[model samples]
Target: MAAKPGQCTERPKSVPGRTAVLPWRLAPGIALFAAVALSMIFAGSMLGLAISRPWLGLGLSPFAPVAKLQDEGALWLTAVEGPAARAGIPPEPARILSIAPLGPGAAGGAVLLTGADIMEEPDVLPSHAGMAAYFARQNQLAGLMAEPVELHIAALEEAGSDTPPPTAVYRITPERRRPLTSLPAAFWMQIGVGLSGFWIGVWIWTLRRGDWAARFLAVAGTGLMASAFPAAVYSTRELALPDPLFWALSSLNATGSLTFGVGMIGLFLIYPRRLVRNQFLFVPALVLGLWRLADMLEWIDGPALGRHLAILTAMGAIIVLVGLQFRATKGDPRDRAALTWLGLAVIIGAGAFVTTVILPVALGVSAVVSQGQAFLFFLLIYGGMALGVARYRLFQLDEWAFRILFYVTGVLLLLVLDAILIVTVIDERAPAFALSLLVVALLWLPLRDMLGRLVLRRREPQRGALFRQVMDVALTPPGHDQRAIWAALLEGLFQPLTLSPLENATQSSITDEGAGLVVGGVGGLPAYRLDFADQGRKLFAPADVALADELRAMLTNALESRAAYEKGVAEERLRIARDIHDNIGVQLMGALHSLEPRRKDQLIRETLTDLRDIVNNASNPELSFDEMLADLRAQISEHVFAAGMRMEWVVEGGDSVILPLANAHTLRSVVREAVQNALKHADAGLVRIVIRQGDDAIFARVEDDGKGFDISADYRGNGLENMRARIIALGGDLSMISGAGGTRIEARFPFGAERRRR
Candidate 1:
């Protein structure tokens, strides 16, 4: 735990709860699907009136009065003094009790229309602005755009106070509404918002159903889809639809908007931290839903109730989001990432709605964006919301979002300006196109680059520097400590609060087992364990694991390279040693024989000894202590005889002890040097060498009787200090005592010292 400022003893609490993100489940998916199905059913049944005949319409002027079926099975005039009235239909609204065919000669038969029957009509794609673009295209292709169709209709009016009710029948001839006349906007809009909202909701529920934010988004999406039904059922309306259908659609829209608001508010309350208990969060939504219901039933006047609730709820949500942003700024990077995307989307999406719809309506002016277009923009909000929930490319989205937003805004603005120029100045399509091209080339592209740079600076100014560090790591030459390099790379990338080896880590990437990341060793050992306990107070995400895997691969390559280089170096050293021994050593031996008989042979012997040492050192031969002792005794005997002196060599105990190649070599050198000094420099007639083993130590002594010297005065000149230093370096000891009687040199080494060093 990091020590907190001003407090030496207090420890920070662990993150309140472990985020147990689970695999997507089937149950939540099914429930989400059910919710959509139920919503569609309810919206389809409650929001529209449908009248079925061979065909139904009247060819009348724009001023024509239109009639519609009411909820109570009544024929009501939605418009007066128009087509219906001109066609000799009565102006008074009447209830239709029943209808019957006049005779076989009648063109068609009709009966009472009920709310249930209307509700039972199949749900159809939304139609608005023009004839549904697809249907219009189909009609135009089929040459039926202006074709006339005959529609049969009848009404059974309720009887007056004293008169019997009468039934009337009429034949109405009207041209089919051009199927494809309307733009395709409504079709695509409905599909876009409805399908995207539904599936995004399902996706959230399936992946993060227990998350408060996910649940809120799920509800919001479902509500948005349900509310969209009203706009979906009509296509390019030149006049009002029937009474029941119009009012029902209006009521449904209000209800759906309210529900959406509720979802928004719920989302605000739960995200980041729970402001209140989740148990009571739904109470506000329920109460508001009832208010919508009461208004729909005419129990209260709620003409602006839905709109007001929507505005209020939105304000509350925005306020909560601001608080979240403040908190997230100092919180987890993941939290900051999520809020960044969400904030960008809210700015763009809400700006569209507010500028084009809300502001215009508030100012009592026509909206720049049509109602159809306004609804389409809601898709943007849904898209952003989904991305935020999924945490897609969270750490990397900052610059990208800025670039995309800038580009989109720039394009839209340029297009608008180009249109203005074309209409007000040029009045030519060709000039408009050219101007658009020019704006993109001369202004937008360069501006995009500039904005990108600015955003990049704001986001990660050290990104380039970090990349350079990574490159340096990758390019580190072979023979360097690869493990140290790996450690440095990790520190740069993750800046882990604490790094430790994870126990029993088996996989290169692991989460649930409590290890943040585990990179396997070359031989399947748990080589590296990464902990993110203080990684911006966030858990390691899947993306972090992926990055670690990539780096680990790089580190593995570096290790392999270093190993290969060391092998090459060793091979080269052996080759050099072999060449020098085979050529120079033979020449030196020949010179020894050619020298004069009286000349000192010690020089040649030393030269040969040096060559042998080089060869031995390069080859790194391993031998047991007994074998090394035998070799040393043989060398000592040759040197003693050459110096005209005798050597009494003895070895006792430690027969089975094996020495490392280095220790064996050192022992050989030390024994050879001592015996030579006794025979040559000390001028001793006979030297006695003894080797003995104790319980935990090996002891060797070389004693000689010669011209005795003062121990301290001649030690440095005789290389006694050098020999002592070498023994001390091996964690052993060397002692020498020389006086008028003799000189004694002793060396003692802890048993298995070389093995312990390894």
Candidate 2:
């Protein structure tokens, strides 16, 4: 048996439950927590260290060789000025007395002390006598000095001498100068280690944050810090250097500073939001680093190159920091905090460099401090960034933190192993080779994991959600009330992901009496179908196949249901008609025929009235096809009687027909319209209604024999046009032909076709 429309043959209710949301899946929150925890730990440790050793708090050491020379010279000049004033002798102008370090077994330059002027040559004292007197005074001063010093003083009477005379000169040979100590070497090593650690930390942090640009900036920052040592050495040798190396180093220093500033600005701009793409900033920074390396090897002019190294290094650091800051701050509030930290780092570093490193070298400042300030500042900035990445998962921080942590830990472990190798390996080359192998082995897993996480993190959330939603909808079984569920799923997936308007191409529907619905398309593509069932618990089939089948099933069910309801109503109406016609009509006829002459007329009239009442009562309900055909036959018979014309009536093929009350009423209206047109316009004596059912169509044909008119010219204003429209609205087609002999109207309805098309 064919199942009725909307009736599921078997209702399968049992289905598995939906998957629950998991706690570990929230990457953002996890990342945030990790970053915050790490930052706090580092910060606390540094803060505690600072409190314990306030002098070691954070700054570069102010005890470079040049700085020491300037300090001692300035001090000696001050002391000499006081003595000269006390003795009532005019003071000699201040000058530097420097002893250049010599080669093996050779005496370096003497303490060449030259000044602007000495006591004005007395008129009584000649040039030779003045020189002798100055030497005697120097010898007396040397005898009074704590350390043994050689005196070599000369006085020139000529004011315009090309070379100024030595005034109160003292020569300090290699024996007199203090021997170089290991303390400076140890201090510098500590500074290097601290700075190197800070840079390494920053690189790890940037990598973890998925900030390639930041990683580059961190490298540049490290380069800048490292340049400081070379810069100091070069500056100390500035006076002995040739021209080319001096200019080259100076230019390099300028370039490095510019590069470092640019890099810092870039880091700042890209740190939080990570959007800057400019590569020009890195070019100068790389060039400076390479040039410094070349200069260190003496591949370039050594002395001159050494002269400008300090400025170049400082310039590089500044450029990188500035570039980072500029890039990082370009983002919104979410990134503002991180960018601010980077900015603070640049400011603190530059300030410390200027005060401790630059000012002391340029001026004769006597203040002395440790060289850990820049390192500490760097640690804070990069550490904070790493913490931000771990805690907030800034730029996929959660994914980044694990990978970064792994890489950092692995690298540290490798470094430790290398240190072990150095201690244990006998061969000089073995340790380095072993260290390289250990690094590669240690980094492999972490690098792989980092790459995997990066790829995963890049997938868009909305697209993933949409895919899940579609799969959920498709897999659910038939007979499930999935309309509301589908709607909710669609809304959830689409609302957040919708960057543009969606084009709805296919019509959607829900079964009126069951638990299933049809969805029209997939991923905004061409029309396909999806049907969810079993309370959206399981899938019946693939979306396209199921949806198409479900739609066909729905159409068939609706048509059959309508057909059954109409038939039942028609049968009920037919029964009532039969009862009135057979029983009541016979009785009325019998009474009228058997009545006496005088009372026969009255009896006949009363019987006729009774018959009419019975017929009226039977026809009072809405007309069915059978009832309509019966009435039309009677009406045409009456018309034939009244008009005194030969009238033929025929009804064909309406056997088990049924229609809804609304549609039955519409049909009646169509019939009435056709009959009225025949009566009013056709002026016909004979009327015919031919209802025939075909495989694809149901048709009603009404024809008449009367005065006919042109269908094209007169039908537009006639009642026939109205009848055609009425029939057409009911998913039927209507046609009218009127000519000299007759008028004919025909209408055909294709059952269920119109609804299916929609």
Candidate 3:
């Protein structure tokens, strides 16, 4: 039913008649619903027959050989054997008596001596001679009689009380036991196939309530169930059933198969992509259905000709599918994946049936598997058809199906080999288990990886990786560029040709055709436009939006980190300015009151040195002890030489060691102030400074040979007080000695204070 030119093929006109009277839209659905309901009733009836036949004992016997129940007063003969029948015992309703032995043991014969013998045996041949005693005396007479024994029984006439004892005796003998019967594989096979078809039909009908393919599938399911019902019924304990029931079931089976075959052909003809007119496809179903009728009625000995017709029709349907696939390949690419899967289902399912059912049965051997069981493989085909009709995404199903199939088959083979080795070669259970684990570990994961790649072909795009690289470059230290990172991330993800702030645009999304998405940037970043045309993709999928969003989040984090780092740098500079204003600024203002030019000039020099040190080490204020000592000696010598005083500086064991910024800064300040005070007030021409390093302390002594001064009077100066306060703040000792030997300033810094400062 290919669509006419300039018309869509998806929706076809409803079939004619009473269905056409209703709204055209609802008629197809109503018709399909009616078809599905009829299918349900037919299939349900078949399942009932399958279930009821077992309990009723139709077509097979459920119990062993037995006779009818009788009363002891009657003493009737029941279930008579051939010997008793041939000896003039009537196969009629009558009363019987027990047997008694006569003559010697080797030549013994049995006779009905008296009626009391029958009464004495409560449930045996004489007293219990009917169905009640059949189990006890079924074949026991032969064991009781040695050699070939003859037994005589007196029986009453039908509908009479008393009768004369028969003079003639009957011979009884034992026979070999016959083997019991079991249900054939065909019985189980039919049930499995039929039940699978029934369920699949129901599922399709329910899922696609208005679809023509679903209605056709229901027909196939009904036929399968009808065919299986008779088999299930006959499988029960063997019992002859009415001929009419068998004929009825067989007719239904044949009709259902014909209907199923027709439905299959029709379904493929119209669904996904129509290849032929629906009306023209029914000729084969009608012809095959007539043949099935003749076969079921015993009018022809066609040798399973009905089944052959069904197979032929199924093959025709497959050929039609191939034609449809060819059409799809040339003109309709969208339908290609669906038809390909349908073809695979047919190939695999038919192959299974031929290998497991038809070939074995044709060879006169038991089938490798039952027909019904093999038909279960057809369910996979039905499932694929349903998926196709519904237009569900196949994704990479066609491309990966074979790879997955091969990988699974290979794994099964490996497991089989492992089992063979464990049984034949590996004797110790522990070693065998270890070897099995090793093999699985080596083979299983790699196989899974290979299969997974085939199935899920989408990989992270190169642009995504490039975006991350840009973010890393922007975020690296010394160049924290937030704007650059944001721009790069957006460009990589969207590739918009005309990227700009969205403020000027009428809408957040660009008004231009083929616009993708708009992101309202936060944290001072302006909104942006993304155009799809520039990226070469006409539209954006949800996955693309999600990728862009994730990248945006990463860019946001990078921006925040950069902002925080810049804020930290700015705050550090401010802190340095405040420290100089509070400590060194107050010292210079206090020195203005000294009144001597030299003292003021000396204060200015020391202040300038302090400013330079603070500025130079603001970023990283930590210094090694050797470096600190060099800077300190340079400051001291400059002040000492300007005052015309000779200086001697010595350092011991100070290399390869470091100090915290606070400790080093305070030590340099204290030394600088002490040397300046020596040059100004000591009045001595020589000054000796010794710096010593101990295991736990740094000791420095500034000794000068100058006139002694009053220590208490000069203790109020800002220089002395600032030096003492700074040393104490760093957990060190500072002391001043004024005497003829010149004032010596001793200072000690503890390692514990340096560690705490760090």
lDDT of each: 0.53, 0.44, 0.54
Off by over 4 Å in 2: 1-109, 113-198, 201-212, 229-255, 271-333, 355-376, 399-758
Error (Å) of candidate 1 at residue 735 is: 59
TM-score for every candidate vs. truth?
Answer: 0.46, 0.29, 0.39
- Poorest 10 consecutive residues of model 1 by lDDT? 120-129
How high a TM-score does candidate 1 get? 0.46
Q: Give the candidate order by descending TM-score.
A: 1, 3, 2
Q: 685, model 3: CA deviation in Å?
A: 67
* Residue 622 displacement (Å), model 1: 32
Candidate 3 Cα errors over 4 Å, as ranges: 1-195, 235-240, 281-284, 290-303, 323-327, 330-334, 358-368, 383-758
Candidate 3, lDDT over the whole model: 0.54
lDDT for each residue of candidate 1 in 134-250, tens digit (9 for 90 to 100): 333322322211222222233333334345445454433323432322223553465457556655655555455556666676777776776666655543232224445554554
The C-alpha stretches of model 1 lying farther than 4 A from their native spots are: 1-172, 175-184, 290-294, 297-302, 309-313, 321-325, 343-351, 389-484, 487-507, 510-561, 588-758
Per-residue CA lDDT of candidate 2, range 234-334, in tens? 23220122234333433444444444544554454445443434445455456655765664454654323432444435545555655555565553333
lDDT of 3 by residue, 1-758 (tens): 55321123454457766454443343333443444445446545644544342211111111112343233333334444334444555564444344443346644344332222212111112211231233233223323432344445444333343565344445444222211223445455566567657655655554444555566666667766765555454333122223455435545655655666666666666555556565655665676677776755545544233354345556566666767655755643334544566667655765566566545443444457534466667666655554533332232122233333334444444655567678889977677766776776678767766755644333466865665464453343322244555666677656665566666332233232223566556555566766552243233334455665665566567667656755765785787788788868876896777799888888888888778777765556565677567556645665666666666776776446777666777777777777778777778998888988787887888888989678888788637888878788767888888888788888887755445321
